[model samples]
Target: MRGSFLYIFGGIMDYRKTVIDKLKEVDSIKDIDIESILEIPKDSSMGDFSFPCFRLASVFRKSPDAIANEIAAVIKTDLNIKKIEVVKGYLNFFINKSKMMEETFEKIFSLKERYGFSYIGEKKNVIVEFSSPNIAKPFHIGHLCSTVIGNSLANIYEALGYHVIKVNHLGDWGTQFGKLMVAYENWGDDEKLKEEPIKELLRIYVKFHDEAEENPSLEEQARYRFKLLEDGCEKETQLWEYFRTMSLKEFEKIYRRLNISFDSYAGEQFYSDKMPEVISLLEEKGLLVDSQNAKVVNLDDYDMPPCLIVKSDGASIYATRDIAAAIYRVRNYHFDKNLYIVGTPQALHFKQFFKVLELMGYPWSSDCRHIGFGLVKFKDKKLATRKGDVINLEEVLDESVARTLDIMKQSASEVDDYTKTSEIVGIGAIIFTFLKKTRERDLIFSWEDTLNFEGETGPYVQYSYSRAKSILRKANFNENTPYDCDYLKEEVEIDLLSKLSKFGEMILEAAKRDEPSVIARYAVNISQTFNSFYNANRVIVEDKNVMNARLNLVYAFSIVIKNALALLGIEVVEIM
Candidate 1:
């Protein structure tokens, strides 16, 4: 039954190809590959869809214009395709406006929120690891990209019908914990911690680092403390548990505000007991070797650096824990794909880690993927928490909400729900800002640029939706009212309808590329196109037929905007 449903739903798989399939039935060409035939013309006036025949000219041994004319001739005979023209090696297609609008709008309204979602991934499970912040450290803006981007990718995958497991991968077991423990024992005040948790912890951490520079012995002490912690010292274990529990409470608040929840909160500590088994398997597979008082996996055969799984003191490193984590996930969930939403600096580390896994003869290692993104810097300066130069993520969220509230108060009149609208706009702005560019490119943080309401910003798109909502409210559409698609023959209306048809395609592309920015950009494009239509076409005009059709178009626009925003982890409000 599931297979039959998949086959039926798969007919609408590639929308771009659907347009080609329609063009192929023209009976002029014996064969047609839409991708090779069609080209989106630079100018809007060319047509909604265009096919350039320049490439075909070489095969046919004829002038480009002549081949274009041949295709256009066949297109002209089809009633569904209203107009076809050939100009400079290009065949332009214009659909019958009324039919196109009616059919497209009906399909969109019928699907509703599920319009763009598909079973492309089927039942495949994807494991995503992200937001692996160290315990006892403040969650700063530097960590925002990984958290939001990872969560958004997970959301995108799930929407596309993949079983997504979000793993926090917290930095729970590390030398930093040892240093914190030492600081706590020497000068830490219990009353101060009860009063101010993160602040007091941060002060002690900073003090440890500052003092360590002058006292080299402090470094050895820190390492020995970590060794003791790893050796299962009762006191160290209790302290580590206390720190993790306290820190998670603070982290949960931020995660709730952002609407991000993980299926698994397992961090480095989760794989502690599993590391020995991993080492035993590695040694059995003849992958592990002794290297300078450590258990290392040599990767020179694959032209990669060796990976250290255990230090001289028999403490497991990140590579060891990661290998255990990977093996555990594969066995536990049987995931088809595993995604690590880590930063670019650790790109080499993951490369080495995966290479070692492959050498260990884990065939499923090929299915593992590391989705590395560039750093999020402040004014081109790296945000170093040790140097106390980091911005808090909570502060960024608070400021964005405050700014959005101020804008709503000044511009909007009688906001139906101020709190809801503020949350929507504020969260939407942050998500859009983070996803505005490709993940591979480094972005400099700037509030002025991110919060811009006038241009290609989140608020701009949200405002477009709000504007459509306002029009719908004023139009008071009724179920019995019949819409006249003929009223939507205007240029802006045609353009918007064409843009709306590509929503499903856009979502698929974003999912395939693992980039949410594709959807973000499409939202801006749709909103911009709709705004142009709204400015030129009057919805509540004197003509009842025209008003009803225009209202239907706006209603459809609202649905698309809301759906797109949801995919980006943004909230949509009816009024702001």
Candidate 2:
């Protein structure tokens, strides 16, 4: 390929692209997409990159082995490939280790913190709507998935040069507020409500539901109060405003501890005024129909139930507000993509919502995506807010910090600030656990898995980074001096360099799949790889050339690992 593209970083070539470009010289396979069939060999003994010739057997009208032999003999070899081996039907290409090491190390040192960033998402705008916790309720563990996942996705997009808009999309409107109003009026204590707003509000919220079983008229009264709120009754509006303000003040404490922020706190209430405009647009397009005296969009043709926009009693539902909010975002931000990081239970709701937008002749509706994740379970039991069975997020954060501190004390590890460092590692542990797996799978929260420093957890990666820092400090490494790649000819060094070389490619792949776990898992693999290299050879050897090369390798690894964890919304501590 001649290394034609000088991507964001300097002199770092894509080896896979090099192999594919070389293969394109063959006339028979020139028309084929060689990139799709290229694979990284499982065993390093085979080769660095492999190209199977089985798919070309039909065109050549010969056996797979014969095709492989013919292609290997005639393929171009002017690139950084040391040798090519034809094993059975596979064409394995061994990379030139010295060139690979030099290129990777040079790129890392040149770019530093900007390593692995690209311009793939240049000039695009993305809106990430997540952590839409209900006001007047506890911020429990159930909200963790959307909050962290959405935040990490934002970070990933920004690394690729995308303009990201983070929206909290607070759940601040509905009949639930009516129930809260009734409960507060009858049983609320003003002093307690002021002391712990979320707790007192949650208590009253649960009581309203419990009392409605014996007295059914309470349900009717709740609905009437909601209608009054919708009608802008002076008393109800004042109460709603007071509760919303208190809830935001309480939610800020948890967000600050987690180091998460939002560009917009515009909740469902923000769209209340925009809903009528959406309804009018639907009517103009002949997409809204009357069903059971309620406004709905018929979707039987799409094999889904009708999407209800308004209740029979003339009240707007969630779908109404969501459609309005989406339209508002497109007009204001002109977003290229809008993503919803809600739970899997709301899958059907989004499907119906998107279909309605499509029917209304909006081409941008296709860019609106729903990123749903599985529920959070404790002891295999799902949490419910109305039942008062939930784990507060603040409690989890505080307890994790305390547990981390206890472990540090038992191990006799000394740090300047025990509490502050422990809090960083502790919260990082929880966030990493939530992101280390695919979002579709349910996550079970446990003390052992979260706090395990020896496992494939966040603390392990953080510890590895700390160890690298310690080594560099002991040796007093000088980055200004040039290092020789010739001395780094060990097998372990090659493997670590190969892994480090793929960071930029791995980042783009993660963005393509819309999965943050890709980066999380990469952090674990790279940490383990660096540890293996350290255990096999010493960085502080007698020879100046060998010591300098290994030190540079260690420095490159530290930089890459820190960048990977940052993409997952994780922070690394210098001491552990």
Candidate 3:
């Protein structure tokens, strides 16, 4: 049974190809789209794989049940299958389990860290634009969803062999900077700025709003300053440049804690010069319409807000800059797909902008997508920066780390590098909390929910990985340890294998849908499955062969879980 596993495994590895090949043998229905008809049965007892015959009923001029019966009878002789059965209108296949275990485990151990990844996506490029925080502003809690989701999507794409360009489209330009500059001039203090850059900036921003309520003319002055900066005035440009630099330095600390990196920091400011070419293109294409002396793209037909190109005072808005940025990215990166990871509130904004691109007759406008995520609220109240009801991301991370340290001390835990481990678990908790939900749903971050150790939080998954690592260390598990795939017939072992087998499929789905929750939830499943397997089976058993096989299974699970966590932008600590 063990020796015959490989021959059977090789045949079933490409189940669709094998099934299609077998269907081709029946001369009466040779042109079947068998791939579309295949399905994974909800009940494992039904079969390993199944194909529905509803569509083929019309082609074969027979009932679905009859077509399934005929196809099942012809496919049974294939070496990969143990048996084929027609139940109702579906053809079900039962792949040999021993063979599956051997091929999967052996390949898993051989490939080790690179198990689920493949080169099927070679030569494709993806540009993931995410976590784009506004310059001179605090990295607030609201920015959490986009930051981690975008990073994880980039990782998922890369894992599937796409050359992913992680672009941080920083919010570094616009009329707002003029207000910031005016605020700094009125209340600028070098010592305060050096001590707390983003906080001081936010302080002045709030101050600007407060004062501007009484001093209505202040808005005009701010816009005038912005025009000066846009005109490349030495003093204004230098001030704006200083703000951008200082804000980035502060953001770097948070990015370091989250372990996220970006390939490009080309923000709205980077496209300042490029906007002219876009404006020229829009004008040349006769898409730019003047409404109330402001340049706009009339898109009432798309049921979206008009894409504002230029203000009445001749200043460019977000839509105008984005148009320039999108065209520049297509010309520069030649991306297979360009994603904008923004909030759901901006759905209309992106639609308007993308519609303008479509109106310009750019064929690749279809390749650009807006991956909109919902907002994060606190205490069931809406969070708005203008209201000053915001929690800084850096401060939240610091508090999480401190909380993690307290938990460790309270539990009297024994883990290496308390400082490093605390940061890992704390940041992991934050990242996991954000990624664990569907991007389109609103999340309220509760202290109890984020730090829960026994639940589906990041700590739970990290703890599982840590548990697997500890077991492997205790068993002195070796890569070359000889083991038999036959010894792993336990229900727990098969359950664990079932979870590990879906790693590749999970990644592909996550990338395709631009959703990180798929991988986040799947990681939790693998972790829970490993814990169940650990309790039911003993790895340091008396039987050396069974022990080796179980240990290898443990090692394989650890790799898959670690890979999953990494994709979610969560770090895995050896012990929690």
The estimated TM-scores of all candidates read 0.92, 0.96, 0.92
Q: Please, what are the lDDT tens digits per residue for candidate 3 over residues 174-209?
A: 888999999999987879898899889988988998
Candidate numbers sorted by lDDT from highest down = 2, 3, 1
TM-score of 3: 0.92
Worst 10 residues of 2 by lDDT: 1-10
Best by TM-score: 2
lDDT of 2 by residue, 14-114 (tens): 66677888899887789888878989899989998899988889887898889889889897665588889999899999887788888889888888887
RMSD of each: 3.2, 2.3, 3.9
Question: What residue runs in model 1 are displaced by over 4 Å at the alpha carbon?
Answer: 1-37, 71-76, 379-387, 478-481
| lDDT, residue 19, candidate 3 | 57
> What lDDT would each prediction earn against the true structure?
0.81, 0.87, 0.83
Question: How does candidate 2 fare on TM-score?
Answer: 0.96
Of 2 and 3, which scores higher on TM-score? 2
Better of 1 and 3 by lDDT: 3
Worst 10 residues of 3 by lDDT: 2-11
- Judged by lDDT, which candidate is best? 2
Candidate 2: regions farther than 4 A off: 1-6, 9-13, 380-387
